[model samples]
Target: MKEMEQPVLSVRNLHKQYGSGCAACRDARRERLLKNYCPACGTVYACQDISFEVFGGEILGVVGESGSGKSTLMKCLYFDQEVSAGEAYLYAYQEGRQNIFAQSAQQKRYIQNHLMGKVYQNPLDGLRMNFSSLGNIGEKLIAAGHRHVGRMEARGRELLAHVNIPEYRVKEAPKSFSGGMQQRVQIAKALSNHPPLLLLDEVTTGLDLSVQASVLDLIKMIQRDFKISMVIVSHDFGVIRMLADRTMVMLDGRVIEHGLTDQVLEDPQHSYTQQLVQSLL
Candidate 1:
């Protein structure tokens, strides 16, 4: 048998905590409050000893309830939150190296530009609400080296259309579109540069079933067409069953069970997994 290739992204013993007593720890507490926390303990550990690997051309789904660390892990992986310990390695082809922890601003820029794509729970947060859908998608392409501004606009329109948005809506501000339409725009933005790894954090939250399914179909099509590795964090088992090759069950910042999606779905071993499956049923 041919040996499997290395994963496009690898995380080991990753830890992220807010409000450590270390003098270097600044007041992330305010940010936490803005996110709907009241008198949030500074010592909250959102992710503890988390580890995972995402291979090229595969989808890994993370399933958990709210406050279960799914979004926290994504935040840490995307470098939006500070990691307290451990390392994450991102594959970089041009320099022929794996960037671990990516502390340097230059390193972060390299990954953000070339290797990573992200979609957030609130689609508007991922896009420039004031910009037209075309402009929102075009911004990333321009940043990725689309030198001709005219070509950028044309390309943006094409991508928006691909996501099933009307070409005529391309020039309208994202704020004017419905939530689902804004989500399509966000997906278009994330796909603009075609990064090897796509991180989706609760991509379908707050939408109606039909809207969620439509967005999901688009994601499925994109994954199949581009063969990009995806890490999707969702509370919905239906979403995981439809998208994942493997599934990881998280609860209280720890992985309870993980394996082939079918294997776990058919016969979950962990008590938490069994409970979650039963609840869904």
Candidate 2:
């Protein structure tokens, strides 16, 4: 059999816990910490033995209700939060290597600069409210050291245009735009560096159906146009069903079901996944 291509992102035996009491818990903290505790129950094990993989050119949808640790998992992947344990390997195309929990500041900076783009649920969180859309996009590009490649001002307007926002709005602050338009700006900012992996945390949340569809469509376009790997964390099954090639149903920070979108939607084996499917229907 032909060997499978290495995953763009590989997470193995991944575990994250909150409390300090349990024996297993102590061993599970990947980053050295003096203490731990179950943030919810005060018992321990906020995340337990979680594992998953994402390949290039794949849209991996992660679904679970609120507090099910959907965002936590994404946070870990994005390096927004440190993992308690397990391997989180990011294959850096620019560096030509697999980075399993990059330790050095330089490595982290390199990855942040050129290897990934992250989008969050809240536009305000990802975008700068004080700056114009052009400023927002240009600022990130400048920070990434892309100032020498092109005129930052021209590039910013081009990105705004690419996202279908009017050229006039490029000079307006994020607060001046409507929610959906603000989201478009966020998407543009995320794409500033053209990272191969895009991590989105409920990018369509709080939008109406029509708006949600449009945003999702934009994301699809980005994935296709850039051939980027995307991991979308959301509870909306309809969104996942429409946008994702494969899906992973997560509960309590563990993957309960994972397969091609059609198979999981049509023949869900896990009770949790079935419930989720039924709820969405």
Off by over 4 Å in 1: 1-3, 21-42, 93-96
Each model's C-alpha lDDT? Answer: 0.81, 0.78
How well does candidate 2 score on lDDT at residue 269? 98
Estimated TM-score for each candidate: 0.88, 0.88
| Model 2 per-residue lDDT tens digits across residues 27-93 | 5442332223443335545466777777878899999888667888877776677788777777664
- Which of the numbered candidates is closest to the native, going by highest lDDT? 1
Q: What TM-score would you give candidate 1 relative to the actual structure?
A: 0.88
Candidate 2: segments with Cα more than 4 A from true spot: 1-3, 23-44, 93-100
lDDT of 2: 0.78
lDDT of 1 by residue, 1-281 (tens): 11277778878888776665333333433344423233434455566688888887899999998988899999888877777887887765443254456458676766776678899999756899998888887778776767888888877887888899997778999899988898888888888887888999999999999999999999999999889999999999889999999999997667888888999898999988998788768
**Residue 148 of model 2, lDDT score:** 58
